[model samples]
Target chain A: MDMGPHATFIWTAYGLSATVVSALILRAMLDERRQRRALARLEAQGIRRRSDVAQERRG
Target chain B: MLSFATLANPSFFMRLTDRVLPWLAGVWILLLAAGLYMSFFVAPADYQQGETVRIMFIHVPFAWLAMFCYMIIAVSSIGSLIWRHPLADVSAKAAAPIGAAFTLLALVTGSLWGKPMWGAYWVWDARLTSVLVLFFLYLGLIALWESIEDPSRAGRAAAILAIVGVVNIPIIKFSVDWWNTLHQPASVMRAGGPTIHPTILWPLLVMAVAFSLMFLWLHLKAMRAEILRRRVETMMMTRVSSAVALKAAE
Candidate 1:
């Protein structure tokens, strides 16, 4: 059997899929870390509502 | 369970993430690296179908993850509806976009692979049509969640929809068999054995593991982000309310 150039289609598809999924995973990680840190800062400043803060304090 | 609620505490979550995120990031990078190496270089080209079979490494895994993500959202939604777990709602909501993304990837990659192999890009095949419906279901859940102003109400409503939509997952899986369609019937996930050879099977399995790990890492990250966003919104609203009260006093 003569295996020819059309085989490139499968390799290209796999390559593109890997690239896209990797990009998404990286983006989610960065966004989550950034947002978590920011929220931690806000929580630390005693900036929450009285009711919410009281719940936390009581717990 | 209330005692364990501390796990969901924003500060506790932040602390846990400091320890966990790096490991998860490392695993994602390492696994993807290994999976790609094995997929592209280590794995041999298919004998019968030649290189086009290589597309299975990505297309099959994404298809699995898309279904897996939908199951997660449905289960979490049910949990939220029954127990009113705020985190479950956050999980269900956060997973919608990611699930939709995976589903879209599956469709696009399948189409790309299909064109050369099946000689068509689009077909009203059963498996393909049901998968498209699953993608739309994800979008609908996301849109419905965003449409409501009240978070709690929105969560409950979206949860109901998620649970109701779950009946379609099995339909999506069985569609190829239930109807004679252009799409191939289940081979890997059959009762007897996978029809694909061991060489192709190993890479595909490794890729599936890598995809699952990636999904876990991202789903956790997205859930954490949703939680933080809610916390930030609450903090901002509190500050505004206090400023109004102080102005009234003055």
Candidate 2:
């Protein structure tokens, strides 16, 4: 019960563990989104490079 | 039937992950909130244990998830190594750290629980020793993957190790049961049924589900990042090669 002295230890452990897990999950998701965006940008740049090459060859 | 290659497409997998991650995150948050409230406010504390019994709320669920995470890695590693499933490698890689985290959590919380109940922080009992072995197994797998230069080869090697390590899972689970140990016997998963009261059982189960969902969300995100990292490296290499060719022409 909340009346016991050891209740603090139990609560502290649970709270800290939950916070750590949540932070890790959030950090992973954010990093993934950033990587995805960077890849998309690189893909677009590659497409631009190819189009420029095709135009130069035609000219 | 869909072949492994179809599942291996990075874009296809990304789309699936996008849809799944949000739902998993949302459910995890909701369940965590609800589970905590139930555990702290609703569930009656043990008559004998006072509040020390409350440690079981986190410890038991984490122990379950630690084993569950290993199973995920083992299964994914098999798919990658045997079937050459590309996503499987990334999934197995991402899951290693998360599983290691869970194992660490279980061990630490179990120790904290033991201090008050057992009048000591730890015992070299079979149950405790086997769980410690499980923790080391995760670390070994992580280190093995990191040490190998070739990704595919690493995946195959780790897969073999994981497959062999499957025997340890049962040993960890049944160690307390098989041998007389200071650790209590299985209360949640048993042949007859869970002996714990429903109020306590409900929160524990919810927390377990929340933890599993959180792991899935993170694992998929990590896999996506890993694939993008590979793509970026390939692009950089291509650009470097072209630049070298231009300098040679000059």
Candidate 3:
């Protein structure tokens, strides 16, 4: 679509916003993955979440 | 009390968010796609502003969300200080950078829109200055959190700063009306009903919802990551303590 004279301003706003939001989502996803791995490593060493321990006690 | 109890349970939260996250992601995508379509193709150009008016779709929402995100930080700060909710600080910490990013966008977009209309990119006026201050406030809170080594202590300090910085929110909102400024006064939200035509208003409102949902999705993801980071820290601490005990015995 033709955005006329102010197309630059309009497109820039949309482009920059998309970039910022995508970067944040990517960072959050990576961090979540990293943390999950850390938790898994601990679990491998016999450390588990409190809920898991309580479940074991009940079982 | 009941809700707080449920929210405080980490495993429960992880499970709950896990289920809801996909829904949030889906809705955000659907809404954003619709909003963008209406924004560019559906909405007509303004008689005065022309296609530049199209910028309002995202700009207004960013400005609105900037304030809205800060409000979230303030409320989470209250939770941190008063109820001492386990995840309160986590929520507050997760929201800071997101709020800062939105605020920065608001300022930049405001400037871009302004330059085309006002003949200047920025001016030291009430609305503009207050938002700039809001950006600084976000930076200050993030810095406060990082500088403190202990998580609990850092959370408390950042909570206080978040609480104190809330005074800026109102000033930013009312600056256009309260003081003479280059920034245009509120068009959609005002004493009377919205002044803009329905053609533009609908897309702007839809865009607002889309942005808010986007923020919610991001905030939840950030909070999840933070919880994991803390878990990792705790695990590291436990390992260090165990190693020290074994060495001491030797």
Candidate 4:
């Protein structure tokens, strides 16, 4: 679509927004992955949260 | 029915978000697609501004979401401080970077639009300066959270700053009218109604809703990550303490 004389301005605005938003999504996903991995590693080493320990004790 | 207390529990909140996020993501994507199509194809070029008016679809929504995100942080901060709600601080902390991103987008897009329309890339306008201030406030909150090691202490400090910084919101909103800024006054939201034509207004409104859903989806994801990070911290601490105890016993 021809955006007339100011096409650069319009396209740049959309491009920058898309870049920033994608970065946010990537950061969130990476952070979630990192935290989940750390938690899993700890659990595998037999380090459990207090609540989990309490539940096991009740059984 | 889940009560506020149940929702406030981190485990319950995580479970609930896990179920809800997929649906929210779907809706956001669909709405965004529809909005983009309408913005590009359906909406007519402005009689005066021509194709440049197209920028308003995303720019206005970004600007609105920037303010809306800050409002979320401010309310969450209040909950963190007064009620000490478990998820409140997490919500506020997760929202900071997302809000900052939106604010930056607004400033960047606004400047882009300004360059073509006003013949200058940057201006010391009241509205612009206030928004810049808002962006700095977001940065300040993020820094405050990072400076304090303890989560509760960091949350409290950031909460106080968030509360104090909220006064800038109204100033940003009314800056156009409050001062003789080069930026135009409120067109879409005003006393009577939106001044823009229906063709433009529809796409703008659609994009606004889509943007809001996008923010919600991102905020939820960020909050879940934050909760997981805290869980990891606790587990690590537990491991260290148990190791110390076992060594002492031996």
Q: What is the TM-score of chain A alone in each candidate?
A: 0.66, 0.66, 0.80, 0.91
Q: Which portions of model 4 miss their true places by more than 4 Å?
A: none
Give, for candidate 2 chain B, the lowest lDDT window spanning 10 residues: B230-239
User: Residue B37 lDDT in model 3?
Assistant: 96
Q: Lowest-lDDT window of 10 residues in candidate 4 chain A?
A: A47-56
Candidate 3 per-residue lDDT, tens place, B1-250, comes to 4686886887678888999999999999999999999998899999998888888888888888889888998999999899988788889999999999998988888888887878888989999999999999999999989899998899999999889999998898888988998888899888889999999999999999988998999999899889888887877787778789999999
Could you say which candidate leads in TM-score? 4
Q: Each candidate's interface RMSD, rounded to one decimal? A: 2.1, 2.7, 1.5, 0.6
lDDT of 3: 0.88
lDDT of 4 by residue, B1-250 (tens): 8788888999999999999999999999999999999999999999988899988999899899999999999999999999999799999999999999999999999999999899998999999999999999999999989988988999999999999999999999999998999999999989999899999999999999999998999999999999999989889999999999999999
Taking all chains together, each candidate's TM-score versus the true structure is 0.89, 0.89, 0.95, 0.98
Candidate 2, residues B20-82, lDDT tens digits: the string is 878887888898888778778888878777776667778887899889988988899888877
Which parts of model 3 are misplaced by more than 4 Å? A49-59, B1-3
Better-scoring candidate (lDDT), 2 or 3: 3
- Judging by TM-score, tell me the better candidate of 2 and 3: 3
lDDT of 3 at B167: 91
Write down the worst ten-residue block by lDDT for model 1 chain A.
A1-10
Given candidate 3, what's the lDDT at residue B235? Answer: 74
- In model 4, residue pairs whose N, Cα or C atoms come closer than 3 Å (at least 3 residues apart or on different chains), thus clashing, are none
**Proportion of native contacts in model 4?**
0.91
**Model 3 lDDT at residue B229:** 87
The best candidate by DockQ is 4
